[model samples]
Target: MPPETPPRIFAPDRRAAVRRRMLNLQQAPDAPRYLLDDMIEDVVERLAFLRHRPQRALLVGDIHGSLQAALEATGAQVTTVEPALGFQEEAPYPFSGFDLVASLGTLDTVNDLPGALIHCRQALEPGGLFIASFPAAGSLPVLRSVMLAADADRPAARIHPLVDVRAGAQLLQRTGFTDPVADARHLAVAFRSFGREIADLRAQGLTNVLADAGPPLGKAALERAIDAFSAASKDGRTVERFEILTLSGWRR
Candidate 1:
């Protein structure tokens, strides 16, 4: 079968923004990154259920380098793939004999989700495990609603494209993975204001990357969005739910 062509719906400017933010994150080192750290913790927690530790592992889009340390703590020789390393379409896919592979917060933004998943499975030896997580399907419902309200009768595309967990599982199975499993973990966060929520998104590389994203909200629209967001607040704090989905499978 021919490879599925990924849509060119994300822009280069978005990639540049992510690079700048990631660089800032590396410097802060000890700064608070709740969402990112949670994903890393979740991945580590899942590893506890495995009978044997992985001998060789791969970490894609290493977040704050915490995951690398965690993987190394288990004595697994781990290799990291950073986005700034620029492993674009033209580059050779590296799936070489890894016993375990994990990715965090990167698959959703990829140009070719299916191709990437396929390569991840191929890189692993038989019985090798793959665990990956991304902000999929039900992420940021409040923010999405606010953005749409900001545009009122003429909503513009302001959110990044998110993968549905069902489709992700299908891709894993289609790519010849065995025992594919996918599940969503919900994170409920309370923020004092919408601006704070936006800041969290920036820190997590969860901004609008859509090539079709329209212009920034004007002053009036911004006010409307703020009001709409505030209306959903409870006890002077807005509640937001972030649905992060974890995908797991084993190389057949």
Candidate 2:
């Protein structure tokens, strides 16, 4: 029998569109890059701590080009495959034999995450490293509460189901990665209003890309959501927390 088809939780086209839009916006002088910058810094720090120096590296989903520049500064030749160039995380990659592979802010949305992980592992030369970071479980609690209030009678799936650290470790081990490690970091950001939070999400290309996303909230529902969001604020500002899950492994 043929292999079973994976459930399509996210739309590839929508993902591509949002990522492309994000890349375009990243070119702007005032793009919101806190999340991306944080992830990049963490990855670089991990590389330094591990004492893993890559002669050739493959970087995925770096919209700002900062990560590539950092990798290059380490004397590693970096090759980037970004969504703006039609790179799909779930799809098979063409090139291989790299000492390091780093995927930032993209793997969480892939339908076939295990397959993607396998590909990342296979692309590495022996003993190569694989690192990825994305918003994971327990993220966006404030926005989630607002959305739930908005859909009072019928709460819709406004947020993507995220992977926790345990699952990340299991996925790495299942995909034949050795010495797998997974951890979470929380980032607290303050927003003056719900609309500003939404805007930040869009700027980071972290908006909903679910294939079966529900219809937009009606005026009354939107108002309720905004009000609920405001009600949860303190001193005219709401604090939202994002849990970034980082996964690392090495190919045997």
Q: Give candidate 2 misplaced runs (Cα > 4 Å).
A: none
How big is the positional error of residue 87 in model 2, measured in Å on the Cα after superposition?
Answer: 1.1
Q: Please list the Cα RMSD from the true structure of every candidate, rounded to 1 decimal place.
A: 2.1, 0.9
Local distance difference test scores for all models: 0.80, 0.91
Cα lDDT for residue 145, candidate 2: 93
Candidate 2 lDDT for residue 248: 95
Model 1 residue 104 distance off true place after TM-score fit, in angstroms: 0.5
Best by TM-score: 2
Model 2 scores a TM of 0.98
Q: 145-208, model 1: which lDDT tens digit per residue?
A: 9999999999898887677778877878887789999888888999899898887787777788
Those runs of model 1 whose alpha carbons end farther than 4 Å from true positions after fitting are: 1-4, 89-91
The stretch of ten residues in a row with the least summed lDDT in candidate 2 is: 83-92
